[model samples]
Structures are given as C-alpha cells and as structure tokens.
Target: MTNHKVDTPSKIEWTELYNQLLDKVDVGIHVIDEHGKTILYNQKMMEIESMESDDVLDKDLLEVFKFHNNQHSTLVQSLQTGKTTKSKKQTYFNNKGQEITTVNDTFPLLQGDRIVGAVEIAKDVTQLEKVIKENVLRKQNTKFTFNRIIGQSEMFKSVIEEAKRATRTSSSVMIIGETGTGKELFAQSIHNGSSRSTKPFLTQNCAAIPDSLMEGLLFGTKKGAFTGAVDRPGLFEQADGGTLLLDEINSLDPALQTKLLRVIQEKSIRRVGDTKDKQVDVRIIATINEDPLDAIAANRLRKDLYYRLSVVSLLIPPLRDRKEDLSLLANSFIDKYNAMFQMNVKGLSEDAMQMLYQHDWPGNVRELEHTIEGTMNLLIEEELITAQSLPTKFRRRYQNSQSSIPEIDYPSLSQDEEIKPLRDKMTEVERMYIQQTLEANDHNISQTAKILGISRQSLQYRLKKYHL
Candidate 1:
C-alpha cells in the first residue's frame, strides 16, 4: 500500500517494560505460578531475601522460601482461598538463616476466570530504629487534644469534664475501658493538656513487656545487675517532670505491682543494682481494659495500686450504651478515612448508617475506624458507603442482626416508555435485592434465605426464576 508503515510492539518490549515497572516499585514483590514455582519477581524481593532472582526463579516457593510452607502464612492462605489477604504481620527466616519480620499483603492473581498465580507486596518491619522513628512521628503528628475525643452524649460529656479537671493537677489518673475503647486517646490528651505537656511524655503497654523485663523498663537498671546490663534510665526517669502512661496496667505481675505502689507512694525509685533511692517527679497514668474491682478480685491488679491510680478516674461507656453518638462517630470516621485514603467519600447511606446504629460495636471506636478505612479502600469506584458496598465481614454481621434487610435501588422509568404493572416492578426489585444478598453471602442458599427473612423454598424459587 503506498509505503505505509505499521508500528507493532516487539514481545521483548512488553517483557522489558513489565520488569522495569516491577523493579521501580519500592515494596518487595513476589509472584508464583499455580504450581507454587517462582515465575517472576522484582529487585526488592531479592534484597529482602538476600538472594538473586536467578537462584530463586523456577524453584518451588515452599522449598526455597521458609515462610511459604507455614500454615499461618498469608501467601499459603491466598493459594487455598483464592482470596486476597491484607497487612498480616509475619516473622520468618530467610534463605541466609537471617530472621525477617514484615507486613505482607498477598492476593491471588487471576487470568480471565482462572487463578493464574499469587502475588505479595511486603513492607519490612524488622528495622527497629525505623519503626520506632515512624511511631514517634505518628504520635507527634496526631498530638491528641481534648476536643479530639469526640462525643456529645451526656455521659461522655461528664467524663470529658472530669478528664479536663484531672489535667489541672498532677494526681494519678486511672482510665478504665474495654479493649479498643479510646483509653490511650484519653491518656495522650491528658498528657498533652497538662502544664508538663512540653516535657517528655512516654507511654508503655504494661501487658507487652515480660515481668523480668518490665521492672528494668519502668525502673532504671544499673550496671552489674544482669549480664551486659549497663546503667540506664527507665521510663519513670526518662519521663521525669512529665506523664508516664502504664497502659493495660492490670497485666502487671503481683510482685511488680507491689513495687509500682511503692514508687507511687514515695515518688522515688531505686535502680536494680543501686543501694540508694532516687527522687522522681513523673505523674503516672494507668489504663486497664477490665473493671478495677474485677481485676482486684481476680488478683490481676493490686487493690493498693488501684487506689493510688484512681485518685482521678475516667470510665468510658461502651458503644452500645452510646447509640446517640453513632451517627456523629460515623461522620467523624468518614472524614478521617477520606483524608487518610485520599478519597472523597461524602457519607454513609441511610441503610448503612442504620446498620451501624443497630449493631453492637464490641471492638468500640478503634474497630469503627478500621471498618471505615477498609470499606473506603474497597470503595474505589464509589463516593458513598452503602449497605450493599460494606465489606463482607461487616455485611454478614449486619445481616445476622434483627434489623430489616437493605433493598437495592430500582431504576426509574421515563414517562414516554410503557410502564410495567406494579406487581411486575415489585417482583423485579425483590429479585434484584435477593440476588445482591445472595452474592454477599457467597451464594449460600440457607444463609441468603436467613438474611433475606424468607423461607428456604421461596428463596430457591426466586433463585431458579432469576437463573442465578
């Protein structure tokens, strides 16, 4: 044809482009075929494993990657379920025998209708210094204030007023709440609002550190006390003239709790190897995830220690008792997730909001925040959170509740077109809603019928009629 030139991409061009793109990504990327043989990977994976691609390629991942063979491994779970697993913290040994700790998000890669393989994106958490620095930065950025503890309910209001009064003095504060309630938020707010706000504010989760290590971490350790132990200041010393938060204080061992009571009473502490007591001016703030009386009864917390810490107490009510605040909390979370995930989610739909209101939030505010963030991540193509669009975990929970099932929105017809009979329109709407409910429950006929509030036979008839 008149010297026409058609430009066709070479097979090598696409492979080179894909490899270049993979290498440019910052996080570790690993891909394995259906047989678990390493098919393609990037430079970052090699760096994380301390191995070259040539050595790993064509090898069975389970045999080469020590983490792959484990039952709890996300990659293995993805292969079994053909589903994506996100942000699972895992610790494993590499090929070089070096231990590695990372947060991995793995997904099953699909080609058309078949699962071709799986891919994982990994973020290293083994670097303690980096993780610590990031935590410090995050704490600094959030900088909790009194106004940030959002709730307008009278009970919450009374608690806030009492909390503000606690900030005016150096008295010890005891914050009691169930897990996932905003115990730490109140602690941080109290510390930041106090006159010693500019001073060193430190927080330690008492439940996290072992009893043997807890003593040295809360009270300084001196040289010769233990092998290779150098003289060092602990949290009480480091947080001098500021606030020290002992989170989950009920987890403290009986012996350690006695020592803690002594320190609080005398306002001093002695190093593990030292013979003399050293004076300190740190204000203690202890939080417990259980009732103080119950904890004392169970011997989990000391009665004397509880009295010292409860000089000023703040008891946060559970979410179920604060239904008046659900809408407010939901809107606040929506705003937060909008900024966090960089999306423009306007608000929750009526059914979605109703679902939230009806369900008892056992995990409290933290759980709500996580749900919002996760739902926002899944709403890539939408601006609002609807009942149908909620994550399966929440959807199933909501469906199990006694609340009415949410119906899908039916399309409106134009006046120029022939209008269907009322019965036909209703049938179409009902069928569509049933189909959505069935999909949400992964086509479990019994569960679908239960969620839809109908007999199994009726659900079966509809499913057959709809050919779904």
Candidate 2:
C-alpha cells in the first residue's frame, strides 16, 4: 500500500481561497453580523448594489442600504428569527439611490447554536421585473376572430371547426403547432368566440422567463412580502373570467409545471408570500411548439400537467401540409398588403403562383404572409405579381428546383431550315447561358459575373445587348 502525504493549507490561504470562490460566483453574496453590521460582501453583491467593498465593509447595514424598515432586509430577518429564508424577494435603494430588487436565499450562520451572522445569496431581478411589466403583463384586447382566419383546405377547415367547438366550452385548451403557424391567432379567435369575449385577454411567452420570476408573474404578489412588493394582480387575476394564454408552456420549469397543474385542478391561486388562496375564474389556453409526447418523453414537459391542460388539445397542421390552400392564402395576403401598401396589384401571375406552391413553407403562414408583404414592397407599376417580382432568395429556390431540368429548350429544326448567321447563333447561345447562370445565382450581378468568369461591366454590356 502506498501512503500519500497531503500538505494542509494554512488558515490565511484557506480564507483567501474562500474569498476568491465567493467573488467568482455570479449570484450576489452578502454576510452581516448579528448586530446588522456588514462583514462580508462579494464582488457580485457590489455589482448588484453598485457599491464598493470600501463603502460597505464593517458599515451598518441600515446606513449602507436604504430599506423601508429593518424587517425589509432578508439577512436581518434570518438573523432575528435564527432561521433560513429561501427564495425571498427583497427590494431596497442603495446609497446610489437605485432601487435594487433581488431574489435572496438567506441563512443564519450558527456556531453551536450561538448566532454569529447571516449569509445571503441574491439574484438581481430588478430589470427582469421591469421588462415583464412593460412587455408581458400588458393586456391585449385581441381583435382576431374566426372570420379573419382564412383557409379552405379540408384539414385546416376541420381544425378550425374543432377550435370553434372548443370555444363553446370553457375547458382549458392546448394548441400545438410549429412556430408561426398562427397558434396565437387560433388562441385569440377561440377567446373572442367564447363567453368571456368581453373580458381581458392576456399572454405570456414562458420559454425565456427565469424560474424565480415565473411564480410571481403567474400568481399575484402580497404587499410586505418582500422589500418592495406591493399588492399586485398576476396574469390570472388580471385575466379573470377571460383567457390567460401561456405560450410555449412546455418550456416552463418542472416545478412550475406542477404548480400550474395544481392551479388547474383547484381553480384558485395563492399570491406569493400569502397564506390565503383566492378563487380565480380564469381560463387557461396554453400553446406548445413541439409534440407533447416527445416533450414528455424528454422530460421537458410533465405528463400530468399535459393531461390537465390538454382537455381540448388542438394540433394545427403546418402550412406545408396544407399546400392546397396556397392560392387562397396568397390572394388574401395580396388583398391585405394592397390595402396596407396602397398598391392596386390585382393578383399573382401563374409563374409566381407556381413558385409559391413549390415552397415548403418551413415558417408556415407567417412566412407566406411576410413573403407577400415583401414582394409587394418591390412592386411599382406592375398590376400583377410575376416570378421576377418575387424576393430574390425565393426566386433562387424556384430556379434551383428547375436546375434538374434540361438547361436548353432547343427550337425544332425544319427539313428546309434557313441557315442563320454564325454570329447570331453564338449570340443566342451566349444569351441562354447567361440567363441560366443569372437565374441559378438569384440574378445577383456580381455572382453571375463571377460564375461566368466575366467582369460585372462585361455582364451588364451583354445583358443590354441581349435585352436579358
């Protein structure tokens, strides 16, 4: 057996290592003595509070940071109660007079049951809360209705019929579709058709929200619960008797998924830091852009929550799957853009329609809508849209698809054919070659010239000579 000798680190070295580790962490850390004097404040805490160690070290916590009262401090609360506080939101102004909000987990340090100090771990959510308020919390009185949804395909019609049936009942709905497939459109239409059409309609995209903010954002917050918390109604409360659309619900944290399931079962919500539950008559309409079974198998979504929210599950087919409606949808977009762009464009040409029908529409309806909007922006005097007026990238896709066909369509030779001049024959061949190269490369002058081993000026001269 081999014995390994280990050199123990000195007390000073150990202390330095601990300080370095604390400074390197992303979360803000602060420790104060039982008497409420700052003892340890890490680099992140300084960044969060916008102060230096010199400004906070050994200073009284009350003097260093402005609080409504001593009870507002999580560190002080933990110190006084001799207990740990987890995920408590605290808001206060620093000496810089900036209102800082943080979600803190504070623990009291004990030396054999004798209170020494309390250490706090905080995550800054001041800016996040502001963004949520400005963007996510605002109510949108949706104007979309079933009449506005346009699609004549049997599959699409059946899906719309199913959605219409859903509106008749108040059961929770789960809309599943690819991104930009008008999941939100269907959601809004369903809400407008429902009995709660006069009520508020709210939405929140759950994919990017941090876990700490999700709870309070969904459920209301109680005043005095945190340093700066006020009595605020959450999405459920704000959308009472209406619909609260939680888009991308599968992206939510599993713990929150459990909470959501509870809310669905109980039909009530308890505000953050509140002891009492409030009954809310809000209807939830959740949407996910993935296969629910796949999400559940990957553990991204909880099966139990899926079962609860999917009482009226809807699978909206992607645009590619319903290509039969391409012409109808294109004409609708043409009409819409005509009014918006003040253009009198009548319709799409046959060639342009063929190109549109060839597209797989990976972005679904939104992509098609934008394509029409974009194509119309380039139209000037043309009354009808031609393939030439389509976006360059779109035209390139159509051209590339045609690349597999024979490059030249030779004119049929007659038995008594009249011979043309050699120069004319060469010019005809050169024009056809240049035209093919131009179409293949999205008609980009520089790219076509480069592919043909000619300068841009040379290509421009040839294009004019051939009237290409």
Candidate 3:
C-alpha cells in the first residue's frame, strides 16, 4: 500500500518551473503585491537596479524603484485597473546617475476574479532609442532625396529615376562614381526609400581598413581569436535583416572580395575562428570610385564577385559633367555654411557663378564645398561671393573669354630706309646697350659686369676689343 502512492508534482510544479524560467531570463522581472509593495524581483532586475532582493522586497513600489515621474503614474494606473500596459520607460540610473531607458511591459496578476499583484518585464532599449534619434537628426540635417540630387539635366534625371525604381526591389545594387560625387548620399537615399525603411541601414568604408583586419571586421571574430577580439559580430552581421552598404568596394583586397562573394551568394558567414555558420538576411549595396569590371579585368577584383555585386549597376555622374547642377549645389552649400558659421553671406554673384562654371572642377562636389567654406571664412562685409574673392588658380584658369593675348599692330618699313640686315640690327642694339651701361658706371668694369650679369674680365675684354 505504501509503494502504490509515489506521485509526481502537478500544476504547482509547472507554476514553480515557470517562475524559475522567469528568474533565469535575461530581461528584468519584478512582481508587486496588491498593497503596491514589491514582493519578488529576479536577479536581472536586482542587478539592473544595483540593489539586493531583500532591499527591494516588502517595500512600496514607488519607494523601492527609481522610475521617472510619467512612468511611475502609468505603472500605478495599470496595477490599479488590473490592465496590461506596454511602453518605453526610464526606470534605472547607473552609478554615475545616467538614466537607462527600458521597454517595459506591465500586466496584472490575478487570483481567480481578484487581482493579487502585477508583473513587470523590462528590456534595455538605450542603444535602439539612440539610433532612432540619430537617424531622425540625419534626416532633418540633410536635403537628400531624388529631387535634391542637384541636377536638372535629362541624363541626371534618368539616373535618379532608375535608382528610385531599383530601390523597390530587394536585388543587389552597385553604384559607380568618382570621389566626391556623392555616391554615399545616393546610397543613403536608396536605402531610405526602400521598403525596409524601418530597418537599420549601415555603411562600411572598405578603403579605410587594412586587408588582414578587414576580414575580421566584416565577418566578425570570436573571443581570443586575435589580440583584442572579444567575440564581436561584424558589419554584415549587424546589418542582417537590413541593408549593408559597402563603400569603396573596389578597395577591398582580393581575398576579402572572394569571401564577400560567398556571403552574397550563400547568405551565410562563419566568423573568423568560428566553426558554425551564421545565416544573414540582408540587402547588399556596394559603391566604388573605379569600374568594378575594370578591376576584375586587372585581376584586382574577383570576376565572380563583380558579377554578383553588379546585379543592378547605377552610375553617378561627376559634378563637372553635370554643369547645370553647379549653381544649385553651390547655393545649397552656401546656405549650409551660412547657417553653420553664422555668416551673412548671401550667394554667389553672376560673374562668380560664371567662373565656377568655366573652371574644370578636378575635385568635384567636395572641392566645391571646400572652396565655398574658404570664401565664407575670408569674406567679411561682402554679401555675395564675387569673382574677386575666388582663389587665384580658379580665377586665372577661367578668366579669359577667348585667347588672353591682346591684338598686335605694326608699322610698315619704308623701302628707301635700307632695312639693316637682321644680324647687323641686333649687333647695333647690343653695342649701344653695353656702352650705355659702362658710361653709367664711370667705366668701372666690375660694376658694369655686375649690372650686365657677366664676368668682369669678359666685360673688360669686350670693351677693349670694341674700343668703347
């Protein structure tokens, strides 16, 4: 009879298991009793608040936790009404007194029909909020759109329309342009207009990193894989579920280019020194100053990689090629610098605009930006940036409407006046100049030599032989 009744734990065991699972979870968790007294707090919650379980338990919620004013009222209301409320709240402050933002979920805990307590779960959202704020600021600060591309030419308009249409698809895109032609801005606009607008759009400059480090940086590395590696994920991993922009993709070394090709084809990457592969769902957008096809031909880039990257290729014209855009771009930069440096400079004069148009802008848009900034710094009272304020090189190169030399006029020689032989005419002129110099110096050979930029002995010999 005693051996017949060894029973297993029932619903109580399941409830206890659930509580254990919540306690071991990574998110902060807490429970408050009907009297608004905190009854239980998991380890994560205690660590986040930097307090002990005993210090928080049996204390009133408002007194136990440091919640912002608005969050405190909302949480109290949710508990009193036995309703569930989810919102972002600032609840904890670090030791340095910096507030930590958290996404919190508060739900009423019921004992049958009566509400016994409330459970709150919070996730740290500080980084996410910071990113959102930064994106908002970037959008507000820049006039980056299809219309703001600074070109009215038909070719430029066609390119913008093509880029906008490409953004609708999830296919890979390659943007080719020279330096300072706003390739990065074009990439940003495409990502912003894409269907994945809400997701992250990250960029990596391929030319900025060394070859050996680039592999690890793009694909990430495991802890202790290298000198300072601490199990970090790379840009490709970070950009998973969104778009990854590879700026200066042509600068990537051949080895890394091959790996990138694999990533693009396979949609998976194994971190350096890691055996397991990670699946990444991302849209790839690559930009380069040089032609990827040329790079492939030169063996600097993998052919397969180039083909994979250029599934849809878009070319951004250099500013010089888009002469019509010069005025628009210049005014945009002037407006920006005017607001930035707090200057009263109005705009460029007609002559100045003409000078800018005529000059071959070797540095493209970036050069124009610097030139405008320099003019603003030097300009004090002049509201308009005139041709006079432009740098000497810019003015000199573009000044002449036609040939810079003036027209010449000559008088006809008389037939009666025997035109001296060409050589005899030059000899007479030379003799007269030497005699005049010697007389001016009182016949001092050294002084005359110095004046004529010749040796004293040579001057004395010439004077004696010529009988001057």
Candidate 4:
C-alpha cells in the first residue's frame, strides 16, 4: 500500500491565500452581511472605487457608499430577494461625482439554510458604455440616405420613394413595420435627407421606459419637479432643430399620448412641475410595430393622437415580404462584419442562401443580421458560410422545413384528418413537423424546444397533446 501525505496550509496561511487571490483578480469584489453592512471588500474593489481598505470594511454599505437606493441597486436587490442578482447594469457616480457604469453579479453567501452575507463581483464597463454612446452619436451624425437601405425589391423601392417624397416636407412621419424591420434606420434616413439634416437627431423607444419616467424623458423636468430632479433638456428640446424618433410609439400611456398630441400641434412643451411652456421646432417621427388603426381599435393609442402623428406614413416591408432582398441583406451584413471583425468571409454558400430564404424570419431583419454576425464570429478556415456553418436554431429550422415536403411524407399523427377541415389538416402538418423535428435530433427535448422556440414544458405539452 502506498501512503500519500498532503501539504495542507494552516488557518493563517489559508486566509492570506484567499486575500491574495481575490486581490489579484481583475474584477472588483465586494461583500456584505445579511444586514447590508460591509464585511469583506477586496483590494481590487477599493482601487476601482478610489477608496482605502479601512474606509469600507465593517461599515454599513448604504451609509458609506453612494448607491441610488432604488430597485436598480445591486446590494438592495440581492439582500431583499435572497437570490443571486447578475448582469444588471448600474449607473452610479464615483467618489469624484463621475457617473460610472458597471455590470455586476451578486450572490448570497449562505451557510446551510441560514443566510449569512452576500458577495458582489463587478466589472467596470464605463469605457464600453462610452464606445456605445459614441457609436450612437455617429449614427445620429451619419446620413443613412435612401441609397443606404440595401434593398432592390419593388415593394421596398416604393416605400423608399414615398419616404423620399415625405422628406421634402416636414409632415410628421409615422413608420409602421414588424419588429426588426429597420424602422429606426428608416427614421434616420428620412432625417438625413430632410431640410434639418445638420441638426441633432435623437430617438426614444417608448416601450422600454416606465410611464413615470416617460413623461419626464419626453418633456424635461424642472429642478423642483421631484427629488433630485434638475432643469435638464428633454428629447423635444435636445432635437429642437432636427428630428426625434419615438419608436414603439403606441406603447405610450393614453394620458401621455394626449400630451404628445398637444406638443405636436402646439410645437411647444412644458417641463414637468413648471408653470411656463417652452416653444421648440422639432420633427416628430413615430414608429409602431403593429398597424396604427389596430392600436386605435384596441385603445392602446389615442385616436386623435394617431391622426395628428400619421400625416406621412411609411411601412418598411418585413424580410419575408422582400425575400429577394435576403441575399442582398446577407451580403450587406457580411460586408459590415468583415470590416468590424476584420474577417475574410466572402459570403454565404448557395445552400446557405437557400436556407435563409426558406426561413419564416419571425424576427425579421434584426434576427437575420444577428444570425449572420453570430455565424461569422464563430466561422474559421472556410471563407464561404455554408448551411452547416449556420447557427443551431437556423440550421435546425432549415432542416425541419426541408423535411416537411410532401415528397418525403413521414408518418402523420392525424392520419384521418386529411379529408377533414383545413384546421385539422394544419394540425396534422404541425404534428408531423414536431414529430420529425424530435426524431431528427434523436428525441432530445431541449434541442427540439430550442429549434421550435418554445419552453421544454410547452414542447412536452404539445408532444402529449399531439400524441407524438
């Protein structure tokens, strides 16, 4: 028998090793007790925060550090929920009053069922945020004229012509399209070609912000409006001489929609909690994912507001609607990433092009762009992206769609439904598609679910419902 002797360190050595290890890491590490008192912030954290070791350790974090104290704060959320909070972007001021952004992951330090403390691992992304802001500024500055739209389809051409004519006059333009059909791109192009091309161009997605903040964002807030509020310029004021694109415009609250209509008609805005109004010259361009008439019918948008905003309407066709442009758009995206990633990827292979056309493209142009960029990022050696080089979701969808042709008829779950109603025939087709998808992947539920874009539980329900 052979005996192995382990060289275990003493308690003091173990503690020293832990501190040295944490201090050597790149990311900032902060720890606090369950009561939100600081306990074990590392040296990296002190350096990032511009503080010394003794300045933070064993103090109540809220009292010592300048956190917003809102739900967006990392420590507050993790301590309240008693769960790991991760990848939440927090914009907070440093000791020098410089607003720094960080992507943080915080986990509760647990001992059995009793909660002891929590630890936060943070990465400073302030520079990355600066780059993103700069890119946005560049887009606002660049001229995305009609020539930059990258499509030659007749339907697409007609829309571009209408947009060009609309740019001749500053009638409020409303662009309607499915999500990811380049509504914002169209908005920017219209702004660039307009008489106000030299002025500032800004955008606000109505659906992304809360109603409480939406009002203040559209119309600037006064110093006395709320706690910590300052007299700042709003989107209307900022884009005074140029254009302000309100994306997902229908998502604004009904009351706010009425206010928006007033601003469009009055060409002025009153800051929140202010008694006076400020006049401004700004072109309002709104975009909706669904039809404006449908939104009005559903009462999601004000009827009067709709009429006021839709003076000049443009509809960007979906990728599936302009299937011919798929190849062109694919090439355009390839060119974009080749410059951005410095890759020599020539273009998609013939089979890959066919696969792109076969897709339904529920996510439209944005999804296609992501698919192409994602594939190019992973692609090595081969200059031409083939069907095999496609993302897992795209490849699976293409394969399942190809297998659905009647020429390769597999066993149908509803065999007797062929002579029945159209709905039953559609169900039979659905069943066959799902069954074949399952079989092709050797009955792996998770992969099949991903291919179909459904939860595993949803797939299981369908499998049982269809008896596949």
Per-model lDDT: 0.79, 0.85, 0.75, 0.80
Candidate 2 on 1-468: residue-level lDDT in tens? Answer: 999999999999999999999999878989999799999999989998889999999988878888875447888888888988777778899998998888788999999989999999887778667755654434554879999998987568877989999999899999988898899889999999999998888888897677877888889788766644567778788888889999999899899899888998999999988999999998899999977877898999999999888999777877876788899898999999999888999999988888888888889899999999988998899999998999998787795775576678777879898788976776778889999999999999878988986545446546755788
Which regions of candidate 3 are displaced past 4 Å?
Answer: 1-143, 400-468
- How would you order the candidates by TM-score, starting with the best? 2, 4, 1, 3
Specify the poorest-scoring 10-residue window by lDDT in model 3: 134-143
TM-score of 1: 0.59
After TM-score superposition, the amount by which residue 407's alpha carbon in candidate 2 deviates from its true location, in angstroms, is: 17
Compose the digit string of candidate 1's lDDT tens values, residues 130-206.
Answer: 33454355446548889898898755777788899888999999988878779888988888888988887777787
On lDDT, the stronger of 2 and 3 is 2
Superior by TM-score: candidate 2 or candidate 4: 2
Give each model's clash number: 0, 0, 0, 0
Against the true structure, what is each candidate's TM-score? 0.59, 0.64, 0.56, 0.61
lDDT tens per residue, model 4, 39-157 = 78888677667778777788877666676646355875677678886566677765556676666778788889777888888766565356336535854576677788889876688
- Model 4: CA > 4 A from native: 1-143, 400-468
TM-score of model 3 relative to the true fold? 0.56
The runs of at least 3 residues in candidate 1 whose Cα sits more than 4 Å from the true structure, single-residue gaps closed, are: 1-142, 400-468
Best by TM-score: 2
